[model samples]
Target: MKLANLSIAAILAASSFAIAQDAAPVDTDGDGMMSPEEVMAAFPDVNEDVFTAADTDGDGMLSMEEFAAAQEDGLIPAEEM
Candidate 1:
């Protein structure tokens, strides 16, 4: 049982690490907002349409709140960071 528990824990850890590594932080500048370019850099699958939709304020940038809202709206993949 101990060995099995250890194995499961190891597997979970590896899975988490892999997921974390696959998702790049969009705000590379640490400015608390993400520009379209920055979003693209972090998530290659993100395009102009996605960025525009995520920029709820139409300010050409996504604040942390906007980004979270976008994720909730399925405009941005939550796992994509």
Candidate 2:
């Protein structure tokens, strides 16, 4: 049981790391947030409509947390990130 639990924990850690990597590229300015231009540049297929929707707070920029939430909510495609 212990071995199985350890394996599960490792898998979870790796998954989290992958998700973070996937999210990293969106912040082109490296300000730890994503602006509309950054998102557009990173994911060219993304448009203003999707970007506007993802900016839940109506702010012009998206925090990492906002981006992650948008991903979880399916507002942004993971493969495009």
Candidate 3:
């Protein structure tokens, strides 16, 4: 039972990691960042204002880190992305 539990835990951990990786918004242009256009394409319902605000760097683009932060701050919904 202990071994089975450990195995299940490992599987869950791996799955979670994979999901997190897959959850990153596609960069589309391979620029290491996501433009508002790219984000809109992936999440049409996202508010432009919210997205602009989440762009903490004012770069007019969002890195994966920024995207995650937005999700955490409720500016973006995880399931919707």
Candidate 4:
């Protein structure tokens, strides 16, 4: 019984670690956190207003969809840093 419990605990711990690793990396833009600026910078030309728009979730922060939309809009460039 003890062995089974230990095995279960180990599996859970390993699963958590894997989940963390799969998560997105920290903000590289140095804006203190990952924001539209970082993603937009990676791609450029992303509409700044979309990121600033309050209607999208009303959180005042850009969601992954919004960021992706900006990319599709050509606001986020693929070159020029």
Candidate 5:
């Protein structure tokens, strides 16, 4: 049972890491920063506030961690918005 639990935990950790890697920070403008306008342009239907909310770090670019954290925070849902 102990081994099985460890294996499960390892698998979960690896999966999480893969997802985190795959959900890379988008460079929408090719200018090295993920600006609010870029995000808005990508999902025009989504409110401008969504991009602002996602950029939690206030670095002017929504890093992968920041975006994922935003989703976890309910600021931006899993959907396009």
Candidate 6:
């Protein structure tokens, strides 16, 4: 019983870490779009030039579609497992 509990705890801890590493829903403002500021907050390594390229339409913000495209184009890193 003790071993089973320990195993469960370990799984839970690992899952929590994975969740923390995942990049998703960076649209923290509920605006359905991502601003350079929001992206930077979520991914500190992403600089302005990278973000401008990701913006695609030069709209100053990334719509969900643009964000997806950026991911597909390899401009954005895949979510860390």
Best by lDDT: 2
* Candidate 3 C-alpha error for residue 5, in Å: 29
Q: What is the lDDT of residue 66 in candidate 5?
A: 70
- The whole-model C-alpha lDDT of candidate 1 against the native structure comes to 0.77
Instruction: Give the number of the best model, judged by TM-score.
Output: 2
- What lDDT tens digits, residue by residue, belong to model 3 across residues 37-72? 877888878868988988999989887778778877
Which one wins by TM-score: 4 or 6?
6
Q: Higher TM-score: candidate 2 or 6?
A: 2
Clashes of 1: 0
The lDDT for every candidate, in the order shown, is 0.77, 0.79, 0.77, 0.50, 0.63, 0.74
Ranking by TM-score: 2, 1, 3, 6, 5, 4
lDDT of 2 by residue, 1-81 (tens): 999999999998887676667778777667877888888887777789988888989888887667877888987877663
Can you tell me which runs of candidate 1 are displaced by over 4 Å?
Answer: 1-24
Clashes per candidate, residues 3 or more apart or on different chains: 0, 0, 0, 8, 0, 0
**Per-residue lDDT over 1-81 for candidate 4, one digit per residue giving the tens place of the 0 to 100 score:** 999999999998886554333223323643333376554555454455745651256665544444444445665442335
Q: Regarding lDDT, does 4 or 5 come out ahead?
A: 5
Cα lDDT tens digits for candidate 5, 2-81: 99999999998886676455443344545445566655655565466777778877777776667667667876555453
RMSD of 2: 4.0
Candidate 1 lDDT tens digits, 1-81:
999999999998886555434333777776767899988877778899999988878999987767767777988777753
Q: What's the TM-score of each model vs. the native?
A: 0.66, 0.67, 0.65, 0.35, 0.50, 0.64
lDDT: the better of candidates 2 and 4: 2
Clashes of 6: 0
**What C-alpha lDDT, on a 0 to 100 scale, does residue 11 get in candidate 3?**
95
The list of candidate 5 runs beyond 4 A from truth reads 1-16, 20-33
